[model samples]
Target: MKPIVRVVRTGTANLASVVASLRRVDAEPVLCADPALLRAADRVVLPGVGALGAAMGTLQGDLGDALRARVEAGRPTLAICLGLQLLLEGSDESPGVPALGLVPGRARRFDGDALRVPQLGWNRVEPDAGCRLLEPGYAYFAHSFYLPDAPEGWAVARTTHGVTYTSALERGPVLACQFHPELSGAWGLGLLARWLEA
Candidate 1:
C-alpha cells in the first residue's frame, strides 16, 4: 500500500504543489487540518508559504500540540520552508511569537546588504555525513529568514546565499528543509522518496 502522508493545512502553504509532488512519489497525500489525524498519521508533511504569525495562528491550539508531540516522539515528519522556521523557537519576522521550539534558535532575516533578500532560484545543498534523506544537489530556495546555525546534535546540511545557513536538518525520523523540495524537480522528488522509505 502507498504510504499515507498527512499534510498539515497551515492555511498559508502551497498545498497543491506539495500534494502533487507526493503523488509523483506514489504516496497518498491527505490535506488535513485535524489535529488527531496529524498525531496519528504514519508520515506527516508540514509545508508553509506565508508569514510566520499567520501560520502560527492557524496552528495555535490542538494542531500545534499534535505537531509538537509528533516531533518530540521522533515520528516521521517533514517540515518545509516556513514549516522549517516554525520548528524553531521564534522568528524575527514576527517578534514575541513563540514557535514550536522543537529545534533550538530562531529565524533571522537574510542580510539584504550582502545579497538578494529572499534568495530565490536553485542553490546547492551540501549534506553532512550521516544524513539519511538529504543529498548534495541544487534545491529550490525561496525564503528571507533562515536559521543561521544548525541545532546541536542534528544532522545538518548547509547552503549559501548571502551567508551560509542550515538548509536541511535530520534527526531520527524528523527532517526539515529550508528549501522547497516539492518544486525542486528530480532532486526534490528523490529527497521525498527517501523520506517515504524511511
Candidate 2:
C-alpha cells in the first residue's frame, strides 16, 4: 500500500526537513497544512523543532486535535524530535502549554544535573532488541531536552551523552524518536526506510 504521510506545519515545526528525509527513503509524503486534508491522511509524520511550550500550544490549538483523531482511528503516526515531546503529559520547558497527554510523563532539559545539556555529537542508542526501528548502532543526537523516564513500559530505546537517558519512546502504534535519523547517516536512513516499509 502506498503511504500518505501528512507533514504538520505547526508552531516551530520544520516540515521541509522531514519531507527531504522521507523522500530519500522513497516514502511518498505530502504537506498537509489544512485541517481537512490532514484528517483525511492515511499515515502522518509529526516532526518539529523549537521550544516545548510554543510547540505544544500549536499542537493543542489545531494540529494536535487532528492528530488525536487520526491516532484514535488506529492510523500510523511518527513523531520526531520536538514532535515526540508533544506526546507527553507536560514538559518542564513549558508546563503551561500542556502536552498531548498520550504518555504519562514529563519532558525535561538535560542540564547535566545528571547528564549534559544540549547533548551534541554522536552517542550510542541501545535499542531493547524489541525496537524494530533501531539500526543496532549509535544514532546521532542533538538536543538539550529529552524524556528522562517514560512512565513504566513506554520507553523502547535509550542514549548516553554523559549519563543514560530515554531517547526513544513507543506507545501503541505511535513511534517517537528524539534524534534526527535523517542526519545520522546510512543507519538512520535505513531506519526511516524501515518505518516506511512497516
Candidate 3:
C-alpha cells in the first residue's frame, strides 16, 4: 500500500502546498486535526506559516500532547517552516509562548541589513554528511524566525541568508525543514522522494 501521511492542519498558511508535495511523492495525504489520526499515521507532517503565538494557541491541550507523544515514539515525522519553529523550546516571535520543545533552542527573528525579514525566495542549503536526502541546492524559504541555537546533534542541514542558520533538523524518525521543498523545484521533489523512500 502507498504510505499514508498525516498532515497537521493547525491553520498554517502553507498546508495545501505541503499536501500537494506529498501527493507528488505518491503518498496518500490525510488532512488531520485529531491526535488519534496523527498517532495512527504512517508518517506525520507538521507544516505551518503565520504567527508562532497563534499557531501555538491552535495546537493547545490534547492536540499538543498527542504530537509530543508521536515525536517521543520517534515515528517518521516532518515539520516545515513555521511548523519547524513550533517544535522548538519557544520563539522570540511571541515572547513567553511555549512551543512543543521537541527540539532544543529558540526561534529568533532575522536581523541584518544584507537581507530583509521573512527571507523570502530561494536559498541554498548545505547538507551534512548524513543528509543524503538533501543535495546542495536552493529551496523555497519564506520565514523571519529561525532557530539560531538548535541542539548539537539535531541540525542536519545549514543555510545562510545573511547569517548561518539551520535549514533542517534530523534525529531518529523526526525530520524538519526551514525551507519548503514543495515550492522548491525538481531538486526539491527529489529530496522529498528520498524522505518518502526512507
lDDT of each: 0.94, 0.75, 0.84
lDDT of 1 by residue, 76-159 (tens): 999999999999999999998999988998999987666987789999999999798899999999999999998997999999
Which of the two candidates, 1 or 2, achieves a greater TM-score against the reference?
Answer: 1
Q: Residue by residue across 104-163, what tens digits does model 2's lDDT show? A: 778877764666578877788887766666656777777777788746756388887665
Worst-scoring 10-residue span by lDDT in model 3? 147-156
> Which is better, 2 or 3, measured by lDDT?
3
Q: Give the runs in model 3 whose Cα sits over 4 Å from its true position.
A: none
Give the alpha carbon lDDT tens digit for every residue of 22-101 in model 3.
Answer: 88889988888988888777788888888999999988988888888887887788888888888888998999899998
- Which window of ten consecutive residues has the lowest lDDT sum in model 2? 129-138
Q: Specify the poorest-scoring 10-residue window by lDDT in model 1.
A: 110-119
Better of 1 and 3 by TM-score: 1
Residue pairs that clash (backbone atoms under 3 angstroms), model 3: none
- lDDT for model 3 comes to 0.84
So what's the TM-score on candidate 3?
Answer: 0.94
